[model samples]
Target: MNHIPSLNDIKEVHERIKPFIHHTPVLSSASINELAGCEIYFKCENFQKIGAFKARGGMNAVLSLSKEEQEKGITTHSSGNHAQAIALAAKTVGTKAYIVMPSNAPIIKKNGVKALNGEIIECEPTLEARESTVQQVIDRTGATFIHPFNNYDVIAGQATATLELIEEVPNLQVVMAPVGGGGLLSGTALATHYLLPEAEIISGEPEGAADAILSFKSGKIEKAPYIKTIADGLMTNLGDKTLEIIRMYVKDIILVSDEEIIAAMRLIWERLKIVIEPSCAVPFAALLKQKERFAGKKVGIILTGGNVDLGKLPF
Candidate 1:
């Protein structure tokens, strides 16, 4: 628990946060399977609390805090889903949440945090600004910082999604997720390593915000060459903790174009009748991009979130 999370750490976190989080379902589409040339199982975290899998990690992180820490409240920097997640989690634990968000974050996500009673402090849309803003909030309010994807507790909580998936649909040949700061991908890798050791753990990353694939290849955290992705939730680069776990366990990180991501997103909406954000579509897009490699395989893909801005949907 102190270092990288073990399988027991993830299981324990799941039990601790279960009351506050939904056991999101595993869904599949025969049409999608036919198209992808693989039997695909989707972990539908779009239906999760706060409408994203971030609910699991955010709840676990807040609930894991000590009484003294809880009294001081919690704070974090996030683009959207994680911000709402921390807000909802703080509310559940009867404490205040101070969220530091970029000025350009979606209005829907901003409203979501407000609905949960989280105090929002907007800053310039950059990582340095976000960190400095969070530090300022911490200094003024004495709130503990809960990183969205970097901390071990958050990673353990994220791992529970994959654990649940494998539990529901065992014997998957490959398991995949989209990489942003690598929280969910690292967690997915860990869960697959522990439970389904034989299963290959892969990830899809936006070619626009394409740092993870480079980091995976270089064995160190790297920034994207340029950032201009419709997948707003995936613009951030990998953190040290997440990068370490991802490098240790993940098999591959595939790159997908915005066009491909949109196509995949539309297919999910049409075939599965589920709404997924662009980042959520990246993994499926990767699968479709390289269908021949995984032909006739059983694959499990974690649909990370469904928090897209309705008016700004690409397709």
Candidate 2:
């Protein structure tokens, strides 16, 4: 039976990765609420290991493999976060990690992978280059490919973050996350389904890179040919598995312009006194832009990652 992940599946992931991951704290800013006219709770995955929530999915993907598969090691292509994730996951499991990164990937992220001892393979930034390069790595090493957002184990792992979020802050009326490849958002939809059944699952997508919103409207999965945004982490197109779950469970997808996203990022930095990447700010941008719609509601926003290059602050 092919379907969305069950509650128990996500629960198991939560328990399995408990020792390796953080039970990240939920923080809120009254200034944000005054500005948005809602009670907003931020599940700050910025504080998670590897500086992002990708750790949960990546760790789960690696650990879920049979001992035989684990011995073969793991490989993945990521611009940043997932690369470090798999590298760390492999390290924890005592296996090799072959990380494929784009030539133009941020220095901060590339250095993080190196610090974790993952072998780095640089390639052209195009999707084709990434896929082909990863395939070559897999063929040469026989390593299992852990897709950034498409694998079942990874999706279940991503769900554990939201499961923790809802459990910590019960009675959320709306839950939102930035939608890129849909791993986090899809997993988030599953969390809302089981934990906060009355909560509406929403997505925040960049206006310049709104593939998820387009797919939701067209009733099918679609690709974005020229996605350009400050939110680099949210630029990837949605995968089929993620799209299926998103279409079935997500209630709405909101589009926020680059200007709005940058503004929201600044607000969070100044108000919360925390560092978050531009991609992490997409959901808050959605909430800020649509203040009236979410007024008087309890909203949970997943700050997906905090892997930003300090040298390139958009403000």
Task: List clashing residue pairs in candidate 1.
Answer: none
lDDT for 222 in candidate 2 is 81
Candidate 2: pairs in clash: none
lDDT of 2 by residue, 147-172 (tens): 99988889999999899889899799
Q: Candidates' lDDT values, in order?
A: 0.91, 0.91
User: Which ranges of candidate 1 are over 4 A from the true structure?
Assistant: none
Q: Write the per-residue lDDT of candidate 1 for residues 142-242, one digit (tens) a residue.
A: 99999889989889999999999999997999999999988898889999999999999989988999999898889888889999988887988899999
Candidate 1, overall lDDT?
0.91
Model 2: worst 10 consecutive residues (lDDT sum): 1-10
Could you give me the TM-score of model 1 versus the true structure? 0.97
What value does the lDDT take at residue 277 in candidate 1? 84
Cα lDDT for residue 70, model 1? Answer: 91
TM-score of each: 0.97, 0.97
